[model samples]
Structure formats: structure tokens, C-alpha cells
Target: MMIKKLFALFLMLLWPSLSMAQTETITHGSLAIDRAVMRAALPGSKVTAAYMTITNNGAEADRLIGVEFSGAKKSEIHSMEMDGGVMKMRPVTGGLEIKPGESVTLEQGGLHLMFMGLTERPADGETRTLTLIFQKSGSLTITLPVKMMMGGHKTSS
Candidate 1:
């Protein structure tokens, strides 16, 4: 058992390239966003939902501090929790913690970005630009293609 553990450690240390290799092409570490989407709400509504995945490839954990986007008055991180038989959605205080070499997916029915007071509805087949701010990585902007729903999405590594 000890020998097997040593072999694993050797691989992780000797082949740092292997540890960095992932299914997705990561351009930078500390902050990243993927599969971001904005769903259209009812007309004259003040809220819309956004979903995505975040990854941190560094050796230390990172924090997602905030998010910003066009056509919205405000954006915040929110999550759903089950209380008894009722499922309630609430703001995610203190941001999100992303562990080293780990990925966290924010999707529908789970954690998502709340776009409030949209200045205009996001039409289909259009892309939305979202700027993600991290405590360590600063800010990153990624253009997310709007999809009908969260389906067929996969996380790299």
C-alpha cells in the first residue's frame, strides 16, 4: 500500500505536465468561466438566470468575488437549498470557494448567477459577455453563447 502511494506521488511530482493537462484547454489559472448562459424571463420581469462552470488550477484555493454583465442592473451568485419539502433559492454570501486543481459547476437547479433588473431581454442566438472577478485572479471576461437550456455540457478534468 505504501509503495502504491509513493508511485502516485512520484507521478504527480515528476510529471507536473500530466497534473496540468485537462480535457479543456485552460488559458489561465486562478480564474475561469465556462458554459455561461442567460435565460430569458417573462416580459417586464426583474430577474434572469445565468449558469456556468468555474475552474481553479492553481495550487491554492481561489475565491469568486463577484460578477458583472451588460443589460442588467445587478448580478449576484445564488444557490438553491432544500428546506423540508420546499426548495428555496438564496444569495450565496461570501462568494464561492474554488479549490486547487478543481472545478465547480453552477447550473440550473443548483447554483447560478442572478441578473436582476435587466434593461432589455436577451434574445436567442446571441452571446452575453460576463466579467468574473476573483479575489486572487482579478477579472476575466468570457463571451457565453446563449443556449436553450443547460444540456450536454461537460466539465474538463
Candidate 2:
């Protein structure tokens, strides 16, 4: 038993890349989060937005219940809409429901996660880990890479 434990530890150290890849791709049950990203807020900005594509591969629906990350006092799922001629934003009280075999995209100008009271802006090339909890899929954690938001940039990653 001791030799088995040592062998396991040796394998982990021998293949560090495998561990990193596993951390980046988080899968819980039948749900998957793809292309998760958070933009660096402008200087002195206290809030920032994060976007991702959530796919429900299971036979039943799932709800995204919560979000968490470092350097954030609070995080909530929000939806942006144009009410009349003005834009409005609101938090999703219950959760965001994802139907089976459907994909919900949280991107700019739409549904996204708002990180409030950030300690510092996410710098370019910086990586942060985000934990997303679901009603049925449990917790899905991924490494969120900070990138510059572009006018024409697409969220196809």
C-alpha cells in the first residue's frame, strides 16, 4: 500500500501538464462550461462582467445557482435588456435554467455574471478560477482567463 501511494505521487509529478488540463476543463454530471472569460475592468472600476457558454447535456434541466471567484465581494447572474429606449440590468433571483441538450450563452449585451466590489481589475494574461454551482450538476470550476474586450471579438472559444 505504501508503494502504491508513492507510485501515484510519482505519476502526478511526472505529468504536470495532465493536471493543468484537467483543472481547466470542469465537468459535473452532464453539464459543461465552455469558453469562460472575464474582462479586466477599467481603472478604478468596482465591477466587471464574466461570460461563458453553458451546455446541458443531460436528459434533465439544470439551473445555475451561484458564482464565486477571488477578489470579488459578490457575484450574481444578471440579464441585460433594452426596456423602452433605455438599457436595464437585473439579477436572476432564482437561477438561470438550462434545458436539456440546450446551450445558454452569457455574453456581452446579454446574460452574464457581474462581479461586484472587486479588489483589483483583472489584467491581461492573468488567470482566475471561478466556481459555478448548479442545482443538479453540482460545482463546476474553471480557470477564467482575463482578456481585453474587443468591439468585434467573438465568444467562440
Best by TM-score: 2
Which ten contiguous residues of candidate 1 have the minimum total lDDT? Answer: 148-157
- Writing each residue's lDDT as its tens digit, candidate 1 over 29-148 gives 555555566775555666677787888878999888799988889898888878899767788899889999898888877888888778877766777888887888888877666655
Clashes of each: 0, 0
lDDT tens digits, residue span 1-157, model 2:
9999999999977675575477554456788777788987767778788899888989999999899878789889999888999767889989999999999999888899988888877877898888898998788777889887864222221
lDDT of model 2 at residue 121? 73
lDDT of 1 at 79: 84
Q: What residue runs in model 2 are displaced by over 4 Å at the alpha carbon? A: 1-25, 151-157
Where in model 1 is the C-alpha error above 4 Å?
Answer: 1-26, 150-157
- lDDT (Cα atoms) of all candidates against the true structure: 0.72, 0.81
